[model samples]
Target: MRHDPLFERLWDGTAQMEEWTAAVSHGAITHVADNIITVHTTYFCGSVTAIRTSEGLVLIDTAKPETAKQTLDVIRSWDDSPIHTVIFTHGHIDHTSGITVIDQEADARGLARPRIVAHRNVKRRMERYEASHGYNSIAQSQQFNKPGYIYPIGQRRPDAVYDDTLSLSVGGERIELFHGRGETDDATFVWLPERRVLASGDFVIWVFPNAGNPRKVQRYAADWATALRRMEALAPAVLIPGHGPVVFGEERAAEMLRHGAEALEHLVRETLALLNRGASLDAVLHAVKVPEAYLGKPYLAAKYDDPEFLVRGIYHFYAGWFDGDAAHLKPPRTADLASELAALAGGAEKLAERATHLSEAGNFRLAVQLVEFASAAAPDDRAIQAIRAAVLRKSIENENSLMGKAFLAVYAREAEQRSKG
Candidate 1:
């Protein structure tokens, strides 16, 4: 295999943080170990792993619909083995959407289709998605910053479903699939006992685990941490993560897993402690800080999901939806409150001016709050609309995670359109 400097640095644990991000976005295939080929599919898309076995290739994840064909093509170029089995790390579209392409390819080659495997809850999750198609469509669109992008409701169903643990042997290699609840309820992480290579599907994303996605369903932070520790126990020599660069050494892989688990564990423990004392969600969200030990680690970067967001998800997992604030239990409509505030501040325009001042003073969080009120109060005021758009744009600049940026981008666009009107 040709040598890749970035891949080498990643393997040697010398790659810079920016290089790690670059590796995830760069669609490249690297043979990290014997019988293990990792494909970095595309920017912001899930990865595909192909394990060359004596029988055939055992594939894990097929990437998203857009990059699935390319992912398979790259794998096929390396080896023309028929895919014996395709395992889903979870039911997420990015992981499951490529099965259709794989099936079609098998038919074209006159080969038998691969058996699909996933946790039983994957089917239930798919059913729920189908039932709430409209809502998912909108939510996904907003999440990805793709307007009018309909969520792909029709996904290839799993042929075999396991509840807790499933073991498979193909061509003399032992592959163990353990059900883990992390980014999703039906998450799975694969372990190759023979090679000691762990394929952590979304469970060990290169960035901070997506355990606290604000726009998604409830993420199990405690369970996610446990899963990481479980993977760490295996002392995998190599780690092929769901999205980023591969880890080469046993010590490096174990440390990364341990750090990820520790970060989530810290959040869960601290957040629950505050909640137990009857602290409000707002107080807990601000008070619970990410551990200093995990800071500056390449794998624990908050580029995708922030730690504060994780705290919110932790609150949701243990406590109910109510944030312990009585005012929020059955709060007045936001527009009503915004109108009253605008009137109290003389007018919406005056509030917009104050928001501009706050924004200029580097107080973007408060600036957006004020501008949103102004926009809501005087919807027809072009000045207020412009100010809202500007403030939201500034917030987007200040944000680190894609979730925050995408959501803020949505509101900014709305304000921009309204400002024109």
Candidate 2:
């Protein structure tokens, strides 16, 4: 394997990865090992791993369609081997949408189309995605801060699907696939025993694991921890993660795997302990906090998903959506409730004014809630809309998680538009 100085620094933990984007965004092709190369297109896009076998090239993932051409070009520059196999770690659009480009490339080159493989649930997920395209588009727009992001409806079905575990011998190297419920139920992480490399899908992202995305489906925190433990047991020398730079060296990769698993396990244990004590969801949400020890680790920072959100998800996983509040079990319509609250407070304008005061006092959380009620009570009120927008802007500024910030930003933008009207 050719040695690179940057890779050496990263492998030995000498690199300063305090800035996550700086660590993950290689922005080009990185020669990982003798026959392995990692194509890191962008921070948001998933990284693609190309493994060269005696027979052909095997791609662990294909990035989003927007970066497909560039990703392909990067891969071609490294090794123009006929891609015999393409693996989908999950059915997320960012990881799987680029298959069309690969298919077209194969057709143009007069080579056989790469065989696509994924967990069985990925096929079902793709079907669900097509059915919920419109809703997903709106959710994506809000989550990604894109004004009018449209989720592509159709996704190509995988050529083959496996359940639990599957092993394949490609080019005399044993490649094993294991199913784990992490960021998605359909997640699969590939293990190359010969090279001691683990192609971890979104399971091993650079930031805190996205075990709870408020805008998306459920995530299996416990299962994700178990998967990481399983990977750690393999003792892989190289780890090609789903979205970050390729991790080189066994102990360094093992440390990352262990820390990530422990972080998720801690959250799961603490949240469940609170729930088991018959605590209300509201109580659990506020009480269970991410340990500072975990947050201090650069890899475990709450940049993409908040721990509070994960606690809510855990509550949903074990308990019901009722939050153990009788009033919430059979609540009044939001608009009706907001209107009543406004009336009790003397008017929507009064609520808006109070929201502004709370925001100015550095209580953006409570300020946003009050502003939301004011807006719901008087959706057409310019003063309320302006206040709502202002409060949300402050909330966004105070937010740490990208997902939370984007959602708040979306609401702020809408409120700003309403204020203009």
Candidate 3:
């Protein structure tokens, strides 16, 4: 019961990317023009867009509640004009939860309430969050390392919603909202015709399209790419993503969207081909890769979501958990497998020792895992303390990838429970 060695490798790959992630988040939007404004939101996330003559004060996605407030605070410093309209590029909590702040500000100023808009699926998404609050919270906590997903549910519904495409003049600016799929079911990208500015949500992360969030539900990579190509066709001068900094020029923006979309489409198409060939799930996951050239591109980095994770998502949709091999329908229990592996490695003590050294080598994730297996094998062993301590140190060191950081944080938390017992 060695388990899939690839799974172990996935664990390592996930760990090794932490340093790369840290270096990437450092990219920032330092300045914005008179027509453009950048909001350094508290979701600890950032978003930017240009206010157009047609639209008084147009906004991309609103950050988390606190961050939304911070953004609004910054906006007040500028032209206190009411937001002509607000767009929720997707249903992520950070982007969708701040309508009330805008509503309140508009009310105080007696300015026309800004129109809230998004893809048609946005309402259902917001409702799902309302209904499954606890489930979302737990999943989010694991991914973002947040204390809890509990937040005051804001009753904000998009004032205007559309299915495929919606075009209008807000504050006299011609804006368009087009639907596509990538990170979430209810996702869309907005384009400002005159300004040549595009506000693409998670569809285009500065790095990779967050096409595969293991913790989230279904994602559509094909449509995601289609959406990107559509935007690239528009030839936007400025590109404002859901997260990270803005793309500087029209040609630059087009290239970024084109590559990001290519990365998504490439993974999806490659994944589908493997699925069509009846390849095992593991084979598909291992086979799909966004060319090294794409990975090395300045805009297409691994700061937000990596491509491999998205590849796994496409594979999962085509085929369930089974590897297409009947033997794996119900493999032996994970704990039982761990026990057998532990015995082979000279019992739990040896595994724990090895894991510690791996942690020292900056392989914090592998270290925690080996420690986990060893601890599972012999809960009462004294090495458990040292093993748990190594996990603590590693988690602390992981600041790059949110999930990698969360991995260690969660493990340390669980280890504490073991200690208490």
Candidate 4:
């Protein structure tokens, strides 16, 4: 099967700038196969797949509100299908938040309201999003590197929710929805055996599987690997992921899925081995490594969630919050701890100076820690705040994953603001 030019660019890693620009503007949509289309945008924020059926259309993972309008326009251009059904591959805003746009489009076209389908736990996920609106808003703002940008709270409730799996006959096409826990507990992967196409949602994104987002809720790496293996067994000819380009050809699709599963399996197994041996969290993080086989795969790059973060997440899932460190069992106030550390180092100024030296030596991780101590020890000190901001900015520059960069940028910007004050 011939791949789209955009897909080729994405697969070869030559379209990063174009992808970013398209995400901010109108993302480019291409026909991956007969009646199957994919919209590629910013990997984390927007990317969706659409399938044209005899009845109307089946959409897997609608893009977010930012690019929803453009996504709708692209779908309309392909065919005036009335969007007979919409499926939320997961509850992530990027995948589910854009249903309203499609709903409105269907209404405008005088078509019946599209039935939204998803796993039943999606409703609970949305409810949790609403419950932790403020906290999520802050975290996403940092995660996306958009200060003060509010996370979308409104969600289009699923019209039909299922537990394990659901088989639907829409427009004479056999659609299968299978539940899998990976990035979110309510994740779903849609398989069209007749079309030989698989919509993988976030389970097999181009980047390393996001089984271990440090700041997010629990992610199930073990279950995630199981789902990937299940999908691999189906031998789909084409794979459309939640993020990144579509995978064409049965050989390529299987390779991507199997390797993605292997990456997660390596992390989970290694992390568990260390934990079982009573290793500390830090030790487990350093011990678990991505297999050499996956290191060279374009689809398995650590541009999003790296192996260390995934290991930490697996550790958290298996163990409790405590890292088996007794001193942290009942830690002193951060300010009090910083004060004592400052006194031992002579003063807050000394800590700040040492942090600056570390930053200069390209030891950003330790520099950030030392600066945090300085900031806490001298909350009102502009000099300490300045040092912290500088160190954080350097950390952000050196980071590869968008999540890490966004978080560091948010902190650096905050420190800069505090210094100004």
Candidate 5:
């Protein structure tokens, strides 16, 4: 409470976010009726999406493992009805963790262990958790709200897996699973033929697709584009996205998918062109542009993932690490260089002052860039705390996207803790 800039900035952003944030719409557990009971997940907690058919209930995505009890609480609210089947759209912790809870509940209550469905690659993806969980933590630290974050690791893996495609008949309802390479290598989107509901998973987030989560591992912008196009083709009337409110009607669904698809395609097309032209990584990063044409598209607007992250992701997708120079191969340690930068900027205090000024002037991105160096060099400085708070506040003001808001919130909080001590 000394200053509370980080939380203040985030709070301000949330206040101004009515236009960008998906209308709550009982997203915590909204029931979308279209011969299908689509349970829309909220932002913080896990959501259990289910489709009841004559054959059985086809549940898409279990909840988080730690919150599986809470997820069960939500599910029980809807129906004490047994979970018939589940489709893990990807192997991410948020989507895959709650399977066993649902499974255990179903079993104890004399319900069948829902046919766990997922892409074949999900096994290998899960193995990453088993093999290098520490590595996952480091990588995920950038995007996730660290304090709010809890890993749901020990859960049952999917029993059924498919590569290109899989078709399931639930109580005479046909649900098609298409393998999609997006945010992760093992991703899938479900298409229901009879009900006209598509469980798009993370493939079509209400805001922008998360193709550019700054700290996460490799993300597929092009492949994400491919998947979005595949989803658009189905022309489902209702869309139950992995996060956010359920989108109703074919027209809205088409527009959402189309806008998201075009944005990714635009970024990928331009990024690939820059790479093909022998531009330096820095040059390619700078040269890539989010098309002016698509800027006005509602879903295409920068809200969750920005084009910069996508450009960097695509750069890695093609170039593979080396930035076309030898010096980067043996780059200086981050702290050492940061110390030098702080000194050159006339110490952390001077940089902090400049950052505060820049924040006042509406240059939050640049302000954070400068302060990150100062903060890293002088981690214990109270001046760094004030600057970080200012940067966070400005970031909230300038943030056209959720990615910016989240990144700003995280670092600001970290700086606040440093300030506390």
Candidate 6:
């Protein structure tokens, strides 16, 4: 019911995203409490929080490496206090990679590098990032629709790692870090008991929780719900999420946390029920839906991660990769299948023509499938490639979520290139 300008701009279609970009570039710093300030960044609505302590400053999370300097500058403007400690809520590049700039700033000030704290699993996550750097790079580029967008591999190692919970006294103010499995296996939520402020890493991001990124690593929906409930129990007066705007007001914060947790819990429960009933993965995906009560909630909109993807993630977590479809158990190569389909449809050109018609008719989902089949069967057909590109471009225009738009844009670009070749 409350007005959220950021959410409004984000969902207002890509053409009007200049305002959102401007918001991130400006990095507005807002003081939520006596000494706590939140810096909202342009990088995916990433946020960095700073707490002025008696000794120095304590920061929770950091912006991405490229934009880290902007975040640091905003904090410096508020207080030039040397950063005593930095807490990484997760190992995501956007959260951890920004430490590089912070380190640089500390060095310039001739102050000791701040102690970096994170979950014990962060080191392993970093190592995995390095090992699978290429795969992650491609996946991230596609996910964000940025071609050649390199995923940050090397991250500043944590000076201290905690398994469950760790308590620290910074400038006589108590800060608690709790490990929770959510968007990532290594996730931490920072709590300031005295200030009643909670910095929920990616777990409480404003956009549908991101618990169902279809292309990324495994997400912990059940654990994510549990963590949200824990935050709700705290009833934080100020809630600063990893991304999006800072939430103020104890009642409002509690409701957001409770409703977010409830949405995930509902999906998990419905998904598990379908699994327990021996429903196929496809059946589960189609059957399990976010309750109608939660659908229109501004926080729970399917702007980024859709409910269907969450259902699939839950199915994979509980039932492994098998979808119970015999044809897919040992499926033929996609190209081979496409070739046969093309033959049955008379020719690849026929399929391409039909795909064009579907695209014009605004049936993008099926249109994309038909176009892909034609392209696979006739990889060198210029007409089919052009048709595929056109259809994907239409899909991109129709997409509401940034992730979906990015993926469709990438496909459209690739198809366009193939057509030109």
How do the residues 1-421 of candidate 3 rate in per-residue lDDT, one tens digit apiece?
A: 1213432332234433334334334322224444667564421463645364444788777667656676676666765666887888877767766677878888888888877888888889878878888887787787777766574565588888898898977656677888887677788888777677778877766556667776778887777888889889999877776765555677667778888777777787888888898898778767888798888775566655656777777787777766687758878876787799888998878888888888778886578778888877877665575577666767567654455566557767766666666
Give candidate 6's TM-score.
0.93
* Local distance difference test, candidate 2: 0.87
Tens digit of per-residue lDDT, candidate 5, span 51-164: 667656677887665566766675577666666778999988778877877777777888678778899988888887867777566545555546544344566778888999
Score each candidate by Cα lDDT: 0.87, 0.87, 0.70, 0.84, 0.73, 0.85
Please provide, for model 1 over 1-421, each residue's C-alpha lDDT reduced to its tens digit, 9 standing for 90 to 100.
2446875665454875466556555467768678788888553677788989899999999889888888888888888999999999999988999898999999999999999999999999999999989989888898889999888877878999999999999887789999988999999999988788899999877778887777778889999999999999999988888887777788788899999999998999999899999999999988999976686676787878889999999998899899999999999999999999988999889889999999989998889999999998999888789889999998899898888999899999999999999
In candidate 3, stretches whose alpha carbon ends up further than 4 angstroms from where it belongs are: 1-36, 41-43, 46-56, 110-112, 149-152, 325-327, 339-347, 350-370, 379-382, 388-400
**Candidate 3 Cα deviation (angstroms), residue 1:** 58
Off by over 4 Å in 1: 1-4, 7-27
For candidate 4, lDDT tens digit of each residue in 1-421?
6776656776676766346446535566757677888876566655677788899888887888887887888777787768888899999888887888887877777778889999999999999999999999988777777778788887779999999999999888789999999999999999998888898988987778888787799999999999999999999998888776677799999999898888888888888888999999978877789876796677887887867788888898999799888878898999999999999999998998999899889998889999999999998888789889988888878888877887788778878988998
RMSD of 5: 6.7
Q: Worst 10-residue stretch by lDDT in candidate 6?
A: 9-18
Clashes in predicted model 3 = 9
Q: What does candidate 6's lDDT look like per residue over 1-421, in tens digits?
A: 3336664444343323346557667778777888888897663746889999899999898888777888899998999999999998988888877888888888887889999999999999999989998999999989977888888777789999999999999898899999999889999999988888899988877667787787888999999999999999998988887887777788878988999999999999999998999999979877888877776666667778777878899899999989978898999999999999999999999999999899899988889999999999999888789989989998888877777787788878888999999
Candidate 2: clashing pairs of residues: none
TM-score for each candidate, following the candidate numbering = 0.95, 0.95, 0.81, 0.95, 0.83, 0.93
Where model 5 places Cα greater than 4 Å from the true spot, the runs are 1-35, 44-47, 65-81, 135-142, 292-295, 324-327, 341-357, 376-393, 419-421
- Cα lDDT tens digits, model 2, 217-281, are 88889999999999999999988888767777887789989999998888889989988899899
Candidate 4: Cα lDDT at 114 = 88
What is candidate 3's TM-score against the reference? 0.81
